[model samples]
Target: MSRGNRWARSLILLVILPHLCIEIYCSKPDPFAAKKKRMSEKVRQMFYHGYDNYMMHAFPHDELKPLTKTFTNSLSELGNLKLEHLSEKYNGSALTLIESLSSLAILGNHTEFEKGVLWLSENLTFDVDARVNLFECNIRVLGGLVSAHILATDSTNRLTKGTYKSQLLNLATELGERFLPAFNTPTGLPYAWINLKYGVMENETTETSTSGCGSLILEMGALSRLTGDPRFEFAALRALRKLWSMRSSLNLLGTILDVETGEWIEYSSGIGAGVDSFYEYVLKAHLLFGREEMWRMFQLAYIAVQKYFRYGTWYHDSDMRTGRATYWQLTSLQAFWPGLQVLVGDVTAANSSHREFYHVWQKFGLLPERYLLDHQMVHPTERYYPLRPELSESTFYLYQATKDPWYLEVGEAIVDSLNLHTRVEGGFASVRDVTTMELEDHQHSFFLSETCKYLFLLYDDSFLVNKNYVFTTEGHPLPILHSWHERLPEAYIPSNWTSIKGEEPKRASAMSMQICPASMHNCIHGNVQLESVCHIPDARDDHRCLSDEDCGVDSTSCRRRLCSMAGYCGQWRYH
Candidate 1:
């Protein structure tokens, strides 16, 4: 009796236990999978939110603050005296204008964008700065013109398409004509800089680095596409040949070079500021133009970056000749590396790098212009983060690729930190002290272009799902027309259009649409109040200014002030 009853019970228990295990574990989804999906959606939301706010409010409106006004007015005050070309003399102004215009175009701001284009038409010309340096001028005029042309013909804007086509084509011809003289060298590498009106320096050394040669693809290739001319593309391709020929045996490139002799000036390599974009452009040039050769070049360069320069935490520059590690500091420009990594299908690496970089931002409340690798300290002298979105940009791409929720959490944390620390009455400001988490009231143009654009895209990539959006070299999104019939020509279109094909559309044009939600404005409300004080040493006086007069004979006196003010002079003596 006992054997039969026990055997029946054991049989029942065995059958039930296996089914229970399957129900508890196998039948239920993996917890990690659920967590990853949630993280991915959050990342998407962060990008979309940031993108919408930027497109609606920030991009359409120029900084136009007192500080920016002062900067621009000072430049305008320089008049024609400051060398009208894109030389170092005018690089700052040209860069500023280019960033602004690029941001506007990305946001699809037709009215303001047309104004910017008209301003360029009236003020800038191939000949205005003809005597200016060649490469700088080329980047400014050729790059600027091609980028503007892309915006002008953007199918989304539809306000002034063909109006600029003739102008843009003529400008492309002029740039192509100007760049021809630089290609006369036997090595095919152009001089670092050229005069627009004149030819290359006969004795100019051909020792150009990757960037000097690599950056030409966007401008020249765009010009080729616009004008239906092959010469533009040929010139850029020649430069690529010269630079690629000089790659170190390791396939890495140095920082600087002689344009005529083809000798490297600085044989250091990394995916940082000076050298980062060279790698970026190789891949992008292929993406934009569908060039297999450029793609091959990118594959080689990217492999070198991954194998040699990349660390678990960051990318470091190495000696070009020895392949030995060199600098490991976080340069201001290195911020774009993660985003570029995401673009190249290296999402896991990109996510790791992004997390490390965001950790720096979390510690400082904003990323310093540069960070020391060993101590994880912000470079005291270079503490300004100019509203760049490289980390956020990477987060956007990672979310897009992996659909991870952690990236959304990262994006939200970034937005919260930015609002809490950087947002000012005028707009977002730069960093004052990375250690102290202080703010400096100077907003950069990329706040709209890359920063806000990435944020918005984090949330609403769906907006771009059907649209062919190609970003500028700086990461400003460019509209790719799906069909010629859907194209928006610049001429004869009003500020608002009723329909794309006379079907009585819902909105006038993409330019007039509001991308951001109203709640985002709440995020922008704050003043960059000076909440912390630090005393800077003054050698002029032995005694610190407790009541102002104690510091110096000529100091203005205050009878009684808070210790906070006295702390500025290290004079807080307790009675």
Candidate 2:
């Protein structure tokens, strides 16, 4: 062991050990990337399995019956409260094809999207004798068309651009014209049901859900922008404005109302099916159209929902007039609220609600249609899990906002659950009951349009890179383009995209470039400090805080709180 020998050994150790560490660091499996690619391909296969089967057995039909390997013209059946008045003579409008259009683009199947668009342009029609729910038709059909039309006309999509006329736009306008007659009511609120061929059906139910008349602005507004006809936008705006006027003093809206009388029919309200999309549309409309009115309505409505409806991230139904708790239960549709909250920069609260929904998803291996929170059990009869996309949709949004690997894991879990329980030889089937994992025959069009699409986008969002788009309730992607707006506000900034600030002024956020409410209090005022998913009463006697000095850092996140303009302490995020 001389000096020369010791020197040689030390050099060997230094060089070899450094190389080994580098190799280990580089080669250690990146589980996130690997899982993402694997799950993405799995989702693609799932989509083609359903899409190909629908083409084989259910093409030109409304929905596929996977168990029977057949089709059902289910357009009239959806949202029909009593499951009555289904027409025997009504043929399909190629419902499955129309729904799958945006999905094709999402999966990067340009050729297939082009082929489907061509087929739909040449063959599909809304001219059949079918009584359809206004909300269902607008979201699934009109939203689908407008979304696909934008993709078709975009040069980046590799679509057959030259040959494409505004064919989809033309069809959308015609369908929109038919929708106009439904708005001819005494109160400006459209009828819940309308006959495609003959307009509003005789003695059609005067009752409509808040969402029925309130969620039309996105589709109809896009139509006006594309076709240069204001009737569609004007009618939708009129209905929305009228519906806003009908809200209770507490800023709550009921689930159902009489279109003819402009009165509340069922005053109990919550962020569930009938009223969920109404809240979503207003916030998104402001983003899409740069309309301050929509933003004001949404800000007030959102604050009210958080104040009265939320209980430690679990929202329950309440009397719209009184703000009294009515139904202490959870519906799968309410899962969308977390995703909507993300758009308003309430990621902390969004994360809290999303985790609860994910926990429920884990419990059932799927999210049941309804869960009785009071009993901590699935609802007795509303036990079905209808391949809903809300959870995955929120998962994607959360991932976009946080870039956390955990959301990708959630996406993986969701993809696994679908493949294990719902995949059939023909197509994906709905869960008739979560308790038994029993399969239902009906394959909802949204299973393709939203569920699979969001799952795919979760794993691979190249389409969303450098682009700003707001997704409709049905998961249709509507780009927030400058050309589509009637008037672009100076303060407006597109979601997820960076804005340029210069001598020419433009809108910006208090915290970020995004123009959403920056403070948690501004977003929603109830429990100002959102540190955890569950509420734990602070030991202090007075919970109110007048300034940032009065508040402390969040216990869970260690993030600072600020005095919101509402004069309450609220959570703040720096990035």
Candidate 3:
């Protein structure tokens, strides 16, 4: 061959080699894709394993006694802290099946979801003599039914296409009507426990938790929207307003209250069992219904909580009137607060609390029911781990927000922990004692409804791809359709807070195309920068600051502002 031909061939090789290397780099399979698929399947199997066992051993009952390999008629016993109201004649209304309906849909088991819906529509009744907790029933049964009905009717799912009716909605409406009698008191606060068959039970306890009264709006409002009946939403809204009005001057709420007198029964409150869902529902109701009033309420309440309840990464109970610290402890349910913070674009604060919660989960095999922060020990009696989904739920939300692979690792660790310590032959059981890792007799319905569902979504979130959904506190998904509400209002800063006018709110949502905090800017959705609506620029001039707090967060980037050496707020350096 000629020397010129050899030189030309060498030049061609150089160009081809560089292109080949670029292709190789770009074409490499996503490391997480296969692992995510595997985890997704693992979650699917875990869900079905528990679900199949519930079908076999606890069909029609409220929950599975995994340890006993039997059933417990537990609907009436739920929230019965004293176990005082077990009804002998009350038959199971297929509580586990109701709870499992939306899970089945999430797992892509449309056939089973359809079958479950049909069976429930035909057989279930709220007429039994069982006295049930209003909160539990609304969230689990009514929320589940409404969610499943929406899924059934949604064309995307292609579920129950030809045979579909509004059966679930009908049942939900019936349950909502039964709930109405509980709201008949002069104060508009519903009783905590009400007999489904008899209406508010004679001489029923007048006392209820803040959450018990305040968290009813989302489910009931959805019911009113779906059925076009105003009573359910009206009752719930009135109760929420009345409860907000009852807040102490510090804008703090007590743990427990009297339904009839509209008075605080337990003046100390924290972001735990008694009051946690109240905060959750208010914000979520705003997202779900696009109600400006709800957003305003949530903004004030959220700020108040941050000012009083927060202590670095840990939150302690405080007196409602004085905002003085009361109880220095951590409950498993408090884990959900971080997820809420993330939704509001407070990613920095959310990450801080999330790490602490994950540390506790790592310390124990799973999250214990209560950990006393001051003593750095598990609460003496409340040491059980109830297969609660709060940690996993938060992890999923954080992953959606940041798309950080580390959050996926956190989820993987959670899945492994649950399988290792909680999975029983019959189903996943709760830990009777986290210290001993002793299995409890029962698996709560929320395990299927929320725990497995959130874990599965962490891996494969295709279900959320094009949909706008706000998950009910029970983890049931409700679609956010602009057509359903009168108008979807954008969040705005109160006139007192800002002098800026007509600025659009910035984009700030995890994955769903939903409403975000008023101040959130340039939300990143699927790696695409979508412009935010009603954006609020930082009011400070030149980003100058003396303290870290003065260096407020960046509105568009959702990044924390750092104090530069020159004493001005600037973007934090990754290093």
Candidate 4:
């Protein structure tokens, strides 16, 4: 009774099985979709909460004392440990508004972004009697203005349609001019501080961090490109070149140097506060401005960093001159390294380091300003969590690379913690003490510029579709244009070599440039396939090698090349 009917049913089921499978596999509802949408909105509200407060209480000031519902003209005080020479008459520059511009665009608040742009255009001025830290001003103010100007004028910026003049650009140019006076030092390296009103202050201190001397390239370079000035770019580049030249033979830069004498004053350095952005700019400068020079420098510098500073999943402060670990501590700022590593296609390494940071974040409920890695405790006095964005910034980049939901969870935790502990009746405040969860009155401009922006992008990245941008140290977005890029360096050839020959030459992969030997692993570099990463660099005559990597791989035998103390690579030795 059922044989023919069953056969017909089976045939029907078979016909539709493939169709059902396609829908189930391809069109299944995204599991994280609802959660991500919810998280994105939460971040949006966080941004608005802080921004609304700043507008109310700190509208014209550099930052908000959210706890006090007051304002602080913090620009001049940035990087000034002693907060010296802060002008009482320096009312404000609407600094928080400038910092929030790109964040507004990223969050799709065109109306607010446009309003802020117009207000800043009309009201902001740099001619105050205030003295400012040059590096801080360049990254936060100049970078912000230039980015907002680009966004305000871009064809896609629907909010500013037909109502825009190049007001922001003109403002940025004026600010860039002010910065030029600081670079007038004999070394072409800029003074760390400058008086916004009178240029460099009389007998201004000449000592500056490595970053102070080297991190200006991106913002200043973008200023030059947008304004056609070339002065800003040249000044920044000259300083960077002089800074690089001052690096030790290990290719590691020190913590502090004297701009006037072009001499290193503080020899200890690592990829943290005093020197982080310098390393960041070298890689990013190559991407943004198409300079092959920065890439070459980054390769050597990266190798040195990996060799000397990196140990397992953490990096400790090291003596740049000697390539020895000097300070075994984890800094909140160092959290940005994972993101940089991701950009370099070292995702595996990035992930490892990111998880370690997440572990520390879980331990403290916030990343302290410093944690003694060896002691496994917070630094005695450096235990404050200023609500920096570096951890979230790295999480966003790692999520972008892998599309892994775990990063979303990491972001969710960050959002929850920020809302739970930092949020106040007015706006988010800094943690003056992580141990007590005590809040500080001041809200940093970067809290708006980077923290919320990175968290928002982590959950919602539609703003990035079909666009390539390099975010400055201040988290301002600068588009990467084909017109701004130069061609990759030419391929390496062995045609003229007297010794060895092997497979066809390929374009040198910067990630493969190693100054020391390591366990080999793979990493990404565009569409170009690279050798197992951490390969020995090419052996060249007169090349001094401290380890086996400097000797490079044997071309014909593909054997390990050895280095002699005489700074030459020798052939493989038979056992």
- Stretches of candidate 4 off by over 4 Å are 1-29, 486-575
Residue 3 error, candidate 4, Å: 51
TM-score for each predicted model, relative to the true structure: 0.64, 0.83, 0.83, 0.83
Error of 2 at 153 (Å): 0.8
TM-score of 3: 0.83
Compute the lDDT of residue 447 as modeled in candidate 4. Answer: 92
For 385-486, candidate 1 gives per-residue lDDT tens digits of 767777777777656544445676777787777777766544566667767766664555456556766765665443454455546545544343322112
Q: Model 4, range 1-575, lDDT digits (tens) per residue?
A: 12211222222211101111112132556678899999999999999999999999888878999999999888888888998888888988888999999999999988888888888877888888989999999999999999998888888757576464489999999999988999998988999999988999888898999889889999988888876667788789778888988989888999988888998998988899989998899988987886767877787887777667776557888888777679999999999997887666545456767887889999989999999999999999998998899999999876765555778999999999999999999999999998889999988989999999999998888887767788999999999887766422223222453222343454554433421112122233356544332333343243445555344443223356666666555656521
Alpha carbon lDDT at 413, candidate 4: 99
**Candidate 2 local Cα displacement, residue 25, angstroms:** 17
lDDT (Cα atoms) of all candidates against the true structure: 0.54, 0.78, 0.78, 0.78
Candidate 3 residue runs with Cα over 4 Å from true position: 1-29, 162-164, 487-575
User: On a 0 to 100 scale, what is the lDDT of residue 371 in model 1?
Assistant: 88
Q: CA RMSD for every model?
A: 21.8, 11.0, 10.2, 11.0
